[model samples]
Target: MIYADKTDLIYSLASTRARIFLARPRRFGKSLLVSTLQSLFSDGLKYFSGLQIEKLWSDRQYDVVRLDFSGLKIFENLEQFERDFKSVLLEAFSPLGFNINKSRENIVFFDQFKSWLLTLPPDSLVLLIDECDTPLTSHLDDDEAFDVIRNHLVKFYTVLKSAERCLRFFFMTGITKFSNTSIFSALNNLTDISLDTKYSQLLGLTEQEISLHFEDYLASAEKVLRLDRNQLQNALRENYDGFCFDRKAQNHIYCPWSVLNFLNNPEEGFLNYWYASGGQPKVLLNYLKKHKLANPFAFDEPRQIRLSELTAAREYKDIGIEALLAQAGYLTIRSVCSNGYAELGYPNKEVELSRAQLYTEELLRGKNLDPMGVPMLSELIETGSLEEIVARFNAGINLIDYQTFPITTEAASRACIQLFLMGAALMPEVEKHTVLGRSDLEVRAGKRHWVFEFKYAAKTKDAAQLLEAGREQMRSRRYGVGPGAGELHRAVLVFCGETRRFERWLEIEDAAD
Candidate 1:
């Protein structure tokens, strides 16, 4: 694996804060960062070798205690839980020349470890904790067990807090953040750099890192992809980039896991590497599945949230759906305002499309619609006639139980169409942003791309009249003129209130101004 130099940041962050916490989506390289920091602290200078941090870091080594909480299983009883973490402790303590007493309870071993740290000089130990929140995620439905597990974790962390004076550097990482009211209150003075601008690119790969460190991978991909240098970069950006975490929305990064996978197999072109990884927090997915219909356009549009919502970590059940989605990596900071409002939406084409297919499937299961219809939609888009496409769209639209899920707005209607098109392998991006304006839906099928404008006619208008209005909207605004905009056809779809279906659908034949 080609490593990008991020030790400069590690130098600044480690030197400034004694206890730091980083919150990121799974597989975003939190464990890897902890591993690098572990090596730097345990073995000091020689470990970093040629890395940039080698010169910046002081020539100092400490007794490093690295603990990954993901390995701890939550059993039904406190005795079982204590016995479970005992194994993790014994192995981690072996290198330090101490056989931790396995007979003692979980908190006792930690307390004993704290006592041993006191034997050394003050601030002489380094602690690295990874996936610290994994233990409590599985007990969401079991509050008693959740509290038992949480209280036990608080005890373990309290040992670290008591031994703060003996710790030179303490770093922790997890996907979900617990607040002051819960496990966070156990450890005072813990600085959360989850949304800190300076460290937003700390875990994810930056544009500079991708261009500098992975040039050979991109070149190989370019040759196999039959695309020039610029095209390859654009494709990578479209597929796996544009995740912003800071308030300013300044640093856009590529998913570290996705980037590495693409670089390793660039000839495979781009895929939904992140979402397809199947590493989503299961508890979060269950939450979304239940509340998905609350706002169908949540991911399609730029959703706004207060700055405080993101900085403070809440219990899973309390965090608003939008903030939950943002923290889960389904949404990212698109922009921010002066008064502490951050607008968030899908980070890139890959996430947007993957979510579309997911939502469409969920809808099908809820409505008891034929799942086969989705594959048929894909086949029609690739080889069928225009009339066949229209029929398929109408059927998908009608599949929604109008009585249960009322469609009162244009957004609702467009969301419905977008889901179906996305199921058909069309990859429809709703309200796609461009310099000119937002195209209602931009989609691609077998190398044929289109810019679609949707119209809602509540009153008297013939199909031709409604379609002309849509065509005018596309032409006057030039809705499709940006990256990957080579040779696109204009399209219009109209829904009449009287018919409650696609009253008109046509692809206009217009080339020049």
Candidate 2:
């Protein structure tokens, strides 16, 4: 079910400034929204009959030029990209009855396009450019090619500013927001509504929209899953919802792509549909590697950023990772602070699990560890075999080559355990704070509660002392004393001189125990 009904967007589109730029993560329906606008501007109201927009929209026809820059392969060099770019533009405009002289230069094409625009009636043309950042994103690794594409886009967009009088409306959609000094420098009139509260729900599915559109699916899923309607809805929300564009807006939106995929095959359980389709962007991976980001699994704290920070170019290394992740749709606003800061985190389980898998692969690269070993850690936890989990962790740690500075062997070891448990959907909580102190890791498997405390010992003889200290800390902090803390398994993990050991001292027996 397509739960997005953004007919109200038409009101904003008509009343706002003519130049508009909207950026959203891929598969969040940017292209679909563009198609809707195309139909609306073309006076195809019949397509939207019985929808909210049908009553609010005015029937008017305009000369619409819709250009989709997606699916164009990035060429090896600037010369090749320019050739392909010109060809793509020509192909897009050819259907509009524009016969133009062939030009490889973007400026030349824009000039020709402007001249053609003059031939049409004033204020009768609508321009929609979809996936406008594909050229830059596809060539992110090549500085020369990226710059060439950015310059070309800047030149082309300048024409929009210059031909303002000839256009009735201009809308551009893309995944990333390039800085003003880049493609949008000349198109100063373009207003970014990506974070505007009025349009936050324009592309994604709001909860009400999901209920309205997928009522039948929800009812059927309740019966099939043997759950009540509310239970089914909550499960769906936990798995596919939690995307908050406007922190002040009470309604959280669901990723339309994941929701639809779940509805298509509810019996298959919740899969990483959107993440599996696109995975992590190569550019994002490259940046994380370059920056040596140690922890990629969590972003719970709210990061403070100015609106300008959001649009700032990626060239600035100081730009926070939180901003990039949020813009890329991996992280989203969880809450808004009074100080104007937007707290961000993974939108849902689909994102968290997929990111955990990606991070695990990144962490274990070239370690000679079996790829299947990660899942085995989860299996050991589920089976409540403490010995096997420790043995598996020690083996994995031994394979990893340790470094002295940032991200040492110990840190990597802890991160590996956390990520493996998370990948298995075990709900591992790291650095959990309690009244006494913070626990290293706390996880649940069935009725068993496992609390781990990690310690490092420089000498082999100190391993026992460190392990005992970890146990004492766990006991003093009462890490395993909460409700349903059934069958608490408290363990201390010690690392010393290329050796690892696990010692369990306390076990609060469950009723069965």
Candidate 3:
């Protein structure tokens, strides 16, 4: 099937400087963009026949060199990485009648390649590098190996800087932006267009594009799912849309891979195709584990980051979790402020649900509780069993490793509950404010609203009073007046030392005052 047309990107590239570096989340069409560039530079208009680029693009040819680092096998050590790096270079150049000696080091090979470019027609070389961060990202768990890979990449990319005069165009794409000093310090002339508003839609499928390209599929899906066109479109958007790269970009860019995969099997129903395509990046997981972030999936609200700070790579300690999550594709820009800050949040339901599951699994690991118990919790909530829900929560808390028990803050507890409920596809809102005050956690299953107030006391003797205080606050705040407001199942949970229990349960019917 025909995919979203990104030939307009070619026009933008042609008018810009030669060297460009783009960073995006995995499965967001980086490699496809690289291939398109290669085809544009080599086969010219023939490959782009009826596409937008065919009308705008000038007829020109360049000797293109495409290097895909993703194709290389996982390296056992630095030696293997370096050897394979050189081999890949040799293979990429060999097709062009340029023989790169396998024994030569990468630096030497670069020098040879640069000298060879001079013998060819002037302005003939167009270098397209894909998955440029594969080696470095693969070794993030090992600091020493990671540095070694970065050093190799530094040497390999330094060639592009020195040979810029012989190149007509150059582009490299990767999932994450390694610190400039760490990898691309030598290539200072390379323009980073990853966040540029003009190119934001260059890689992903915009809502308009989705409608234009998938009209037939949408019709078919609507008929099969027994929904109207608008409902079907909204369903698709909720599941796979809302990825925004540039702060000024108005169009919500849906993940190309997810969109295509759904079209390929519309009958299978909605699924987390993109998330399931690959394991969570070890680097991101390590960061989350290190920070011990309580609410990894959703922020209480959108987070703001300056445009300059958005892509500026810093040490993990200096980098905010929101920024890391945004770059990692688990979160996306929700809005941009006039002061040059962008508010970020989970891009869509697919990301929100997938991350909730992953985070819940991590929280439950080693605690001997079923991570899948999240569904049971939702079931209990749906049935309006406040006692069972509280019982299950207490039991789960008791099973947590003793050393990790006795969480210090109520916010953490609320985050855990939100994550659990979200994992089961239940809507959870933390610190949800009502007419009077904010509730600790509010979970919604269908039309039922479960309001929870947590009380932490240093002694068991204070638990009962604290729980009463919680219930009083919920009652005074009138926390059950929002949309889908039904029978309010309110519970007060008190924690003391290593023990947690529900002190009170109150069910207020919707018909009651």
* Candidate 3's TM-score: 0.86
lDDT of 3 by residue, 1-513 (tens): 585677787778964547888888888888888888888888888777788877898757878899998865387767887888878887887787777656775547667876666676657788888987777666556678777777777777776676677778889887677673355578877788878888888888888988887788888887788889888888889989999888584756988888888877888878788778852665577666566664443444567778777677666445777777777788888888888888888888888877777776666764533345354776788884766776777666665554553455566566656776776667677787777788888777766777787776766677768776776776667776655677567766776654554344444443233
The alpha-carbon root-mean-square deviation between model 1 and the true structure, to one decimal in Å, is 4.0
Give all TM-scores, in the order shown.
0.85, 0.86, 0.86
lDDT of each: 0.75, 0.70, 0.73
Clashing pairs in 2: 302-343
Give the per-residue lDDT digits (tens) of candidate 2, residues 277-350: 77476556756766766453333334556544565555634547777777777777777767766666788878
**Runs off by more than 4 Å, candidate 2:** 1-4, 15-17, 102-108, 247-251, 294-302, 313-318, 366-369, 372-375, 399-401, 404-416, 431-440, 445-449, 456-460, 472-488, 497-513
Residue-pair clashes, model 3? 0
Best by lDDT: 1
Model 2: number of clashes? 1
TM-score for model 2?
A: 0.86
